[model samples]
Target: MQLSWSQPCSSGMIQLLLVSNLLLWECVVSRPMCLDIGYKKLFLQELFDRATVIAQYTSNLTMQMSEEFDENFAKNLEYKARNSSTCHTASLTTLEINEQIQQTQSDELLKVMISISRVWYHPLEHLVCEVAARKGTCETMLSKIKELEEKNQELLEEMKGILVRVHPGAEENAYPAWMGLAEVRSDNEDTHHFALSNLLHCLRSDTDKIVTYLEVLKCQVIHNNNC
Candidate 1:
C-alpha cells in the first residue's frame, strides 16, 4: 500500500507534537529559558546592576589613567597630537547601539550587540597588550583592562545565547574599518609618548561608549515591550 503526504497522523502523535511545540514556545517567551541557561528575569535587573557597577568602575579607572598619563608621561614638550585613522579610539563603539536604535527589533538589537563585541574586543586587547609591554604601566589599570576584556567576552556570550532563542539567523556582521587599531612606530620619545597617550585616550573614550551602551541595553532587555 502506498502512503500519501495527506495521510493524517494518529491522535497520540498529534498530541505529542502539540505539547512539544508549546514547550518550545515557552522556552522562547520565558527567555534565558530552561535550566541550561541563566534564568531570564523580567527587566534583567540583576544583570543591569552588575553591568552598571562594572561600567562605572572601569570608566573611572580609565579616566584616572588618562589623567595620570597626561600628568606623568606627558612631560612638557612640543608633541603634535597624533590622531591616525588606524590608531583611533573606541568611543564610537556604541554609535550603532543607542536608545534610538533600541526601538528596532530586539533580535536585531541583540545581533548588533554581539557584533559590537566581536569588532571591539580585539582592538581593546591590542591596546592593553601594547600598554602592558611598556615598562612602569599601572598594575591596577592592567588588571582593570583584563577585567574589562573578560566582561566583554561574557556580554558577547550572553547576547549570543539570547539571539539563538530570539533569532537563530546570524549573518556575518561588518565591522567598521576604523574599529581595528593598527600598529604604529614608537621609535622616538615624542612619538612613543604621543602614541601611547593617544591609545589611552582611545581606550578611555571606548570605555565610556561601552558603559553607555550597556546601560541602554540593560534597560532595553529588562523592560522588553516597555522599553
Candidate 2:
C-alpha cells in the first residue's frame, strides 16, 4: 500500500468545520492555563470518542465476518496477515507510532495526524459506496473522521500551527508521519470485504494514536509543562 500524505481540502471547508466545532475558548482570559487545559482535553475527548466506537464496531464486524465466511479460508487469511505486519499494513503501525515518540514533540505529531485524517475524507466517500462495509457503519465512520479531522485542525491552529515547538536542539524532525489511507480497488467480494476491514482496522489504530498523543499533550499542559 502507498503510505503517503496530502489531502486536498478547501479553505471554505476548514472555516465551516471550525465553526461547527468551535469551543468557547475565550475563557482562556479568565482561566489559568491549567484550567484551560481541561477544556481542551474535553474537546479532544469529544472529538475522538466516536472514533473509539467505530473501532469497536469494526472489530466486532470482522469477527462476525469471520464466522460467516468459511473457517478454513478465514484461518488461511489470518495466517497470511500474520506473515505481514499487524494492525495495519501501512508503513506506520501501532508499534512504530508508540515507540520513541515523546510528548514534547507534539508539533510534528499534530502535523502528521492532520494529514492522516485528511487522507481518509475523500476516499471514504467512495468507500461508503462499496459493499465491503455495512451501510450505517461505514457512513458513521466517514462522517466522524471528517468531523474530528476538522475539529483537530482547530486545535492545531490554536496551538500556533504546531510547528515551532520542537525541542530546542532536537536532531530528528521525523514529522508529517506516513499515512496509508489507500483506496479499495479489488473487485472480488471477499477481497473487497477484506480490504474494507483492513481500512477500518487502520482507521481504528489511527484514532487510538490520536487519542494517545492528545492525552500526552493534555498531561504536559495540565502539569505545567512538566511532561
Candidate 3:
C-alpha cells in the first residue's frame, strides 16, 4: 500500500528547495492523514505556474537587456568620432530613454538584470587577449552572436526538416514565409544585435538543462549498471 519515490524527484526537490525536503508524500498513502489532497494539488499547480512565469519573465528581460546593450554599443559617438555633435545628442537621448523605461516600474525587469549579472557579468582584471575583444566591437559581438544564432537556427531547421521528412505536409501552413520572418525579427538584430547577445546569454544560462539531460542519461547508466 506504499509507493517509493523516484531518485530524480528526490534529488531535484532537495536541490530545488534548500530549506526542507517534501514531506507530505508519506501521508499520501496513509489515507491523506497529514494533508488535504485537493489543496495540496492546487498548491502544486500554483507552484508550477510560478516556476513557469519566472522562467518566461527571466527570458524576456534577458532579451530586452541584450537588445538595449547592443543598441548602445553599436552606433556610439565615441566609435565614430568624426561625426557631428551627434554623440552629444545621443547622450541626451539615452538619458531620456532611461527615464521612460524607469517609469514603467517593472521589478521583474530589474530581477532579470540581476540574474544575468549573477551568471555572466564579470569585472575585467586584465586584458592580454586582443584589441578586438578589448573593446566590445559590433563585429566581434555580432560574430559571437551569429555563431549561437546559427546554431539555434540550425536546430530549428533540423526539427522542422525531420518533421517534414516524416510527414511531408506537417508544416505547410504551420510555418509559412511570414512565420520565418517573424521568427527572424525575434532576433535582436534590430537594436544593434543585442537581441542576439541576449539569446547567447540565455543559451549559456540554460546549459544546465543539458546537465539535467545528462543526469537522466546517468540515471539510465546507473540503472543498467545495477542490472
TM-score against truth, every candidate: 0.59, 0.44, 0.25
Estimate, for each residue in 24-122, the C-alpha lDDT of model 2 and write its tens digit: 454555478767777766665454444345434433543443343323233356634633344332443222444445534455555555455545554
Against the true structure, candidate 2 reaches a TM-score of 0.44
Clashing pairs in 3: 188-195
| TM-score: model 3 vs. ground truth | 0.25
Give one digit per residue, the lDDT tens place, for model 1 in 38-79: 454633556556656765676787677767766666656443
Task: List, residue by residue over 1-67, the lDDT tens digit for candidate 3.
Answer: 5446653456766676754334444445656644565565455344333433444443444354445
Pairs in clash, predicted candidate 1: 43-222, 90-206
Residue 40 error, candidate 2, Å: 10
TM-score for candidate 1, please give it.
Answer: 0.59
Per-residue lDDT for 171 in model 2? Answer: 33
Q: What shift in Å separates residue 127 of candidate 1 from its native position after superposition? A: 3.1
Superposed Cα deviation of residue 41, candidate 2 (Å): 11
Question: In candidate 1, where is summed lDDT lowest over 10 consecutive residues?
Answer: 84-93
Better of 1 and 3 by lDDT: 1
Q: Candidate 3's C-alpha lDDT? A: 0.34
